[model samples]
Target chain A: GGIITQTPKFLIGQEGQKLTLKCQQNFNHDTMYWYRQDSGKGLRLIYYSITENDLQKGDLSEGYDASREKKSSFSLTVTSAQKNEMAVFLCASSIPQGTGNTLYFGEGSRLIVV
Target chain B: GDSVTQTEGLVTVTEGLPVKLNCTYQTTYLTIAFFWYVQYLNEAPQVLLKSSTDNKRTEHQGFHATLHKSSSSFHLQKSSAQLSDSALYYCALSEPSGSWQLIFGSGTQLTVMP
Candidate 1:
């Protein structure tokens, strides 16, 4: 059994300020991902890392940056926070399945921009 | 671009009632796989079921979903609903040949009332 831990469960940031969210997984999975969750919009992938130091962009990676400095940790930075923006950020890790992978997610970090 | 669509935003059912959540998807690749993920309140999402074989029903924890390749659909269903079943459900698509990414749809929130 392993766990994914996301720091700062609640985040409050000022408009235009840069905000960072961190994640750590003990599963020793090779793939890590960051996703943004908004009300009624489900989850949107922002960035993913296949292994240490590897990065890939997803549909909503425009205002975000991610880094996989170590295999156990992945970090996401909001380049510029938008006014009145509120969303939950989720971090996940997975082991490759036959053709697809099953993801294990963190509790999530909520970002509130004022 | 590959995408998934979950038609229902919210589904409320009484205890012991049948439950169903509709999901549809589109992809250009020849091989396609689908997954159903469940998210409980304030918790991370977890894979509930997955299938790639057409018309073969996959079940887990009393939940079942069948992937219909011809219709580009993989709808989640359960014979009986329970209070513990209340959660947010997401449908996702993956085409390993195209990309090792999982595309998700807007989630359906199911509230199984007692």
Candidate 2:
């Protein structure tokens, strides 16, 4: 049983400030993803990486950037924080299998923009 | 484009009563899987149930869901609700034949009261 760890449980940033969230997984999974969770909007995919150094954009990728530095780590960066924006960013990893990939998520990092 | 829809944004139920959470989806892929994820307070979301077989039921932790391809629905159900069952539930779609990304629904917050 491996674990996914996300750093900085809470991040308070000012408007237009740049913030970065980091995730590390010990599952040795080949795929990693970053998702944004809003109060009523649910989880929206920002970016995903199928392998190390690979990146793919999702529906909510406009304001975010993602990096898959290695097989065990994935990171997300908020380009420019919006005023009064508050959301939780989640990081997940999965390894594809015959049945399907079951994502394992980190606790999440809450971003609060003032 | 793939998308998931969870009809209820919030549901309050008395303990020991039957509970149901509706989930529907739209997808272009023929072969796909549906997942029910539960998120406890301040905890990461975890898979509660998953099904790829059409018209077949999958269950975990006393929660069950059946994937009905004809209706594009995978609704979660439980015969008895417990106070500990209160949490946020998300319905997700995954195309195993394609990328490893999961498209999530708006999510439903279930508050089981004693």
Candidate 3:
């Protein structure tokens, strides 16, 4: 019965600007992840935190930064916004129960760069 | 590199008919696990099913998927289509014994017609 909440349902940023997205989970999960999804494309992992203060880069982490300040919160920062870089950013949390445990996700934050 | 491929970008079927979505993967592990994730409009992705045992069909909400290790495929199937089933479906892969990280496919959009 846990819920994940992402702040700012929509965001508009200019090129070279920096933006941040926040996520919170009441599940008290130990693992959290951030992903970017473009239209008609598969979601690409940006970063993940297995525990508080621990961060791991995914394939597409060069332009993004993430922080796990506590067990319930994870934040993602766009280092520099790129023009026409519109995508949805998703936050997910999972309990440590191996695979098939199901990942709980937030509604996501939609970013539009101009 | 672990990867997932969903052959169809979109699938359309009449309600009350059977439906299937194809998913394939490439991985070094002979027993790589596969997952089906469903994303409704304006919502985050949710796990529909996940399994690694070959030939054993995993079912959820009347949806089923069987992992075929030899072919590296885990195709989702349903006996009857419903309008509510329309959504974006993603196939994912993960090593059964190695990492908890998941690699996702491009995804398929399912549309059930009345």
Candidate 4:
């Protein structure tokens, strides 16, 4: 059994400030993903990495950057925080299976932009 | 483009009564898998059930859902609801050829009362 850990469970940032969320997974999975969760909007994929040093743009990738420097770590950076924005960001890892993969997620990091 | 849709934003049910959460999807890929994920209060979303084969029912934790490819639906159902079942549920679609990315629906929140 392994776990995914997200740093800084709560982040408070000022508008136009740059903020970053970090994720670490010990599952040794081949894939890692970052998703933004908003009330009534569901979960939107921001970025994902199929392997170390690889990145894929998701539907909501604009204004966000991701890094996969190592297989166990993935990081997301918000270029400019939006004013009064509040959202929870989730990190997940998964191993590919037949036609699908079951994801394991971290508790999540909540971001508040003032 | 691939997308999942969960019609209900909120559902309230009495304990011991039947409950259902609707989920539908649209994808260009012929071979895909569907997933139902449950998230309790302040917890990460976890896989509740998954299936790929058309018309085959998948069950877990007393909940069941059958994949109906013809209708492009995979609705979650339970014969008896419990207070413990109150949570946010999300339906997701995974396309094997689409880099195994899981596209999620705009989740449904179920509140089971005593």
Candidate 5:
């Protein structure tokens, strides 16, 4: 039983401000991902790390940056917060087994830009 | 260009009645995997079922889904709806042979009535 922990259950940032969200996983998984969840939009991938120091962009990575400082920790940063950009950010980790890479997700951090 | 579409944004069913959530996908790859994830309130999404083999049914927690490549669908079904099943369900796609990213659908919110 592994767990993914995301810091700051809620965040409020001003327009053009930079904000960071942190995630830590005890699963010792090889892959970590950050996703943004908006109403009626599902969850869109923002960034992912396959290993320490590795980063890959996803479908919605335009204004976000990610860093995998350690195998157990991954972080995401909002470059410049946009007003009314309210969404839930999720962190997940997975261990690839054959073709079934089952993902485990964190509770999520809700961001509200003013 | 691969995407997942969960047709029902919200589904209401009476307790003990059969329930089904439709999920269809568009993928160019031959070998792909599908997943059903359940998210309760204030909790992270968890994998309920996963299937990679075409025409094979995958079951978990009394819920089942079969990957039908011919129809490009993997719909989640349950014989009886329970109040505990009232939650948000997401359909996801994994392309292991390509970007190795998990693409998710908009999600279906299931409400079990007493």
Candidate 6:
């Protein structure tokens, strides 16, 4: 079995500051995704990478940037933080991307913007 | 735009009782697929079950959900509730024939009390 690791299990950032989050997986999956989960809200996709250096914007990609530095790593950057923002950012990987599919996720990185 | 709707935000149940969480989705695609994901405290959301076939029941970890294409719904259910079942549940949808990006609904917090 493989595991997905997200760096800095918790993050505290200042408003208007830039925050970066990193994820790495040992499963060698082809698709990697970053999602944001606000309190009481559904998980929203921020960005996704089909392969190394490939990037696709999701519905909630505004104010965020993502990168697939390599096949095993995906990174997200919060362009500007919100003073009261509090959410969990999840990193997931799939062998391939499509329906009739399952995803594996990292433990997640909790962010608290001050 | 693709979207998912979860009717309730919280569902509390007593142990040994039946459980159900309503989920519905809307999309402008021909072939649709649905998913139910569960998230435990401080953990990443995990896929519980998935279905795309109309009226077909999908089951896992004692939970079941059926995709009703005509109604644009895929509600989660279980025969009996247990303490371990307590968690936040999310509903998501994707169009099989189009992009495989998942659109998720606002999650429901389920507390199965003993």
Cα lDDT tens digits for candidate 1, A1-114? 999999989999999999999999999999999999988888898999999999999888999999999999999999999964589999999988777888899999999898
Clashing pairs in model 4, backbone N/Cα/C closer than 3 A: none
Off by over 4 Å in 4: none
Candidate rank order under TM-score: 4, 5, 1, 2, 3, 6
Candidate 4 lDDT by residue in tens digits, B1-114:
678999999999999999999999999989998999999999989999999899988999999999999999999999999999999999999997647889999999999999
TM-scores, each model vs. reference: 0.97, 0.96, 0.95, 0.98, 0.97, 0.95
Best by DockQ: 4
Docking class of 2: medium
Binned by DockQ into CAPRI classes (incorrect, acceptable, medium, high), candidate 6 is: medium
Superior by lDDT: candidate 3 or candidate 4: 4
Best lDDT goes to which candidate?
4
In model 2, pairs of residues that clash are none
Per model, state how many residue pairs clash.
Answer: 0, 0, 0, 0, 0, 0
lDDT of 3 by residue, B1-114 (tens): 778889899999999999999998888766556789999998889988989678998999999998988787899999999999999999988765323778889999999999
TM-score of the second chain, each candidate in turn, equals 0.95, 0.95, 0.93, 0.97, 0.97, 0.94
Cα error of candidate 4 at position B63, Å:
0.2
C-alpha lDDT of residue A12 in model 4:
95
Which residue runs does candidate 1 get wrong by more than 4 Å? Answer: B97-99
Q: How many backbone collisions does model 6 have? A: 0
Docking class of 1: medium
Clashing pairs in 3: none
lDDT of 5 by residue, B1-114 (tens): 788999899999999999999999999988788899999999999999999999999999999999999999999999999999999999999996434678899999999999
Residue B86 displacement (Å), model 6: 0.3
- Report how far residue A113 has shifted in candidate 3, in Å: 1.2
Could you tell me how far off, in angstroms, the CA of residue A73 lies in candidate 5 after the best superposition? 0.6
What local lDDT score does residue B53 receive in model 2, on the 0 to 100 scale? 95
lDDT of 6 by residue, A1-114 (tens): 889999989999999999999999999888899998886778888998888999999878999999898999999999998865578899998764445556788989989887
Candidate 2 vs candidate 3: which has greater lDDT? 2
* Residues A1-114, model 3: lDDT tens digits: 889999988989999999999999999888899989986779898998888999999898998899998999999999899976689999998875555445778989999898
Q: Can you give the DockQ of every candidate in the order shown?
A: 0.76, 0.77, 0.62, 0.86, 0.75, 0.67
Query: Which residue pairs in model 1 clash with each other?
Result: none
